[model samples]
Target: MSLIARTGPQEYECRVGVLDSLTEKLRVRGITKVLIIHGTDSWDKAKNYLTQLMDSDITLEFALFNGECTHEEVDRIVGLISQTQAEAVIGVGGGKLMDAVKFAADKSSGVESVLIPTLASNCAPWTPLSVMYTAEGVCLGFVIHTKQVNLLVIEPNLLLDAPVDYFVAGIADTLAKWYESDVVLSRPEYQTNALLLLSRAAALNCRDSIVNYGLQAVKDIQNQTLTPAFIQVSETIIAVSGLVGGLGDGYSRSTVAHAVHDKLTAFPETHTFLHGEKVGYGIMVQLAIEENWAEIDRLAVFYESLNLPKTLADLNLSDLTEEQLGEVAAKVAVDPILLQSQYRVSKEVIQGGMRSLENYLATTV
Candidate 1:
């Protein structure tokens, strides 16, 4: 049998003030000598919550990163962990910081880490994979070091301070979970209870929050009010995106959506667009290719109405030539997941979809 079964730990605690009981949990798991990995943010906003969790004897160290998870940042964090002989890592910040901890802790002498998410941007906390980058912003490998997560500590009050755009993008990312998964999981060899559970949940709730909340979710962000819909979106990103998306056993996400995003990223003009925004557009493009016209048009209105990028210009890439898009398509061709998985996704087909998306976006606005 595999060393780590594709299952969560026997016990998990997803709660507010998770840190108040954290010391006991760590002691229960035999974890000591914790490292706090932080990103650039307002510590004051979360100071009280963290202070309550700190035990008198727990040795703490700070490993800092600016906004990005660069190679240098990882090195600094890892260097600190290596020098300190810490037993576990506690990542505190938004998704990027959590992702960095996930990447570094596994490589730091096999120490497990706890993810304390301060914002519900994406489900980076729940996943075993870390999306890493070079110092120069080149996309590197999706670091899949540890298949285990020790804890996910979330306090809704802490999230009330977050910028609503993070939550909005998070919802967009989760929406793709169901749509992309539906295509990928249909492959006979890879479908499973876990994948079905995740994809179905994601699909069902894709539009529910927005439909129910309307502009209230956005207003909640403006007012810093944690509405019921906001909580659902946050939970989806932190819980479903990380755990469910990570545990999609043998399932493929190499669908038309992500492929189109990959191709779009080839051009520098589209670089400023947020990850979720790109994926949202990608999902629309994928639906168009799959000829799910009903869903595609509906999604198009939502994406456009929200001032999200529907065409290249919206991504600030109105001037990109077709050659740049082709280059992106070629670069996307390199991911091994495209060919090695149970589902068959052709490079040519993906390129065609990208071209179709580009054409559609050109005419969309």
Candidate 2:
């Protein structure tokens, strides 16, 4: 029998003022010299908290991320680690920077890594995978590492400073965990799988938590108050959402939703939209493909409240001709991940779903 790897972060802490304890956390793990990879803007905001670490005995170095998590960037960071002889890497920024640091640390043998998300954008910090993109910002693929993060520190205070849009996008992305995974796990063949059972519970938690508390969470984020609702929703996004993928393994991996997001990346016009925004629309498309109109209507209402993308126009693909959409459909249909769905998907089906979603949106509006 093949061995299944069920691993998560060695240590996970979510609380206010957790950033102050970062250096000591590393020290306890015997991590001495550390390389910190962060975004320019995020670093500017976090410098004050980071200053506290300098007082500790741990040696530190800094690397500025260029906004894309490409293989080249990972290699460059790995090179820096080699030269500096950094024992560990601390990623203190958003999803892209965290992914870059994670990939680099995984590639560099014997080096451990920690993630401190400056924005609750995606579950890049907790998962053992990096969503790779081209330098030009096109989605290439994702790389699965052999291990989960060494530590995940989520300081609610730090997250509160992030733009409200990031939190909304995160909600949309986390919600996809349920819509995307539920269809596959509901299949009879996989019902007995223990991992899928755990994954289903996690996915449900993501959906329910967001549905019950997401609106209030967004409000709290706008007010810069870390209320109970906000904390619950944020953890649902970062921690519980990661568990959906971690426990489910390949069976619960994203299906049509992420496939559409990947194909949408090929268009520069769609670049302005966040990852979750595109996936939010992709969820509608997936529902359309399944002929689940009621669920689509329910989600459309929720997405409208959150300002998530609901139509091609919302994704900045309003002017796209049928031929252009067909090109995107072709890509999505061919993606290997789409096959993970319990039902077969085709280019024609994707195109039809796009039309159906557009029609539904038109009538509703």
Candidate 3:
């Protein structure tokens, strides 16, 4: 038996003016009627690039993505798809919008999905999974779907206008591909698994590309410039990062870093933090658990340069009660995703990791 990797969408394209072909592309796929689910702000920005879809004879029904990939949102999208008899569903926005459409389309008898990401925030546009959340924005894990997206097209112009904070958060999120996967992939037993090896290579690319070009990419986004570094970093975040989990499956899927992020979401104070920002802090915690101080030191410099969260204070958890901190550590210690790594961490160890990271950061200063 061989490993089956759902690496990305069936048809993926990234370039300037790509959405200009949106109508013809859908038409060729036998998709005439579509339910376009989008965020208010992102859809407004994406509208300029989708002139073809608007002018074409295709029947279009528009629905607003309610800012979360909650079950209610997915159900609403699915209901719209059924009522409109849409042949396809197009998602135009950030990760949550795309995830809602993807999951809704799958539930709606596997209707074709076309994703247009307005923000280079995460791999939701590329991966065959949806990171589900509550209506209140708490993490509820994720669900891997049976079908891949029918099409995913990225227009650099649209992403160039995205908020720089999301771009930086995307970089931090993409960097986790390396930190999360290497823990398990570097083991001896999986040495000969070719697909996992490919995943390992992709994970390394995600790390190196982001580290080398992330700052410049942030600057490019800030200046609204479509430079080579911007394109490379954006694609690395959206496409290359997908390969880490797609190719390796559970082995390279989120480990401790993401589990930490998930746990932190339970705190209301951390609600203001972006997904990747918390994961950035989680990376330091994961390193502390492994007692890998050298790598932690290396990453701390990068974290500081990007204004990524490296300590509890950075995540606004500096004043968290001892009981509250213990609760978080206990929850994270038992997270199912944490088992993916070779580590066997306990609640005390998790708490110690947090303290060690804070102590280490203090020493660095």
lDDT of 1: 0.65
| lDDT per residue as tens, model 2, 81-159 | 9999999998989988888998999999999989889888788888898999998889987888987799999888888
Any idea how many clashes model 2 has?
A: 0
Q: Which regions in candidate 3 have their CA more than 4 angstroms from the true location?
A: 1-4, 340-343
Worst lDDT window (10 residues) for model 2?
Answer: 1-10
Instruction: Estimate the TM-score of every prediction.
Output: 0.86, 0.97, 0.97
Candidate 3 local distance difference test against the native: 0.89
Ranking, lDDT, top scorer first = 3, 2, 1
Tens-place lDDT per residue, model 1, 1-365, is: 11122444324555556667777767787776888876666455766777745745667776665666766777778888888888888888887777788777777777878877777777777777677765545556466655567776777767767766676676677667667666765655445555555554554454465445635666676787767866666776667555444455435333545555655655566667666778777777667557676776677777755666665566787676667655665665655444433335455655576567667656754
Query: Against the true structure, whose lDDT is highest?
Result: 3
TM-score of candidate 2 versus the correct structure, residues matched by position: 0.97
Clashing pairs in 2: none
- Model 1 lDDT at residue 362: 61
Error in Å for residue 86 of model 3:
0.3
CA lDDT, every prediction?
0.65, 0.87, 0.89
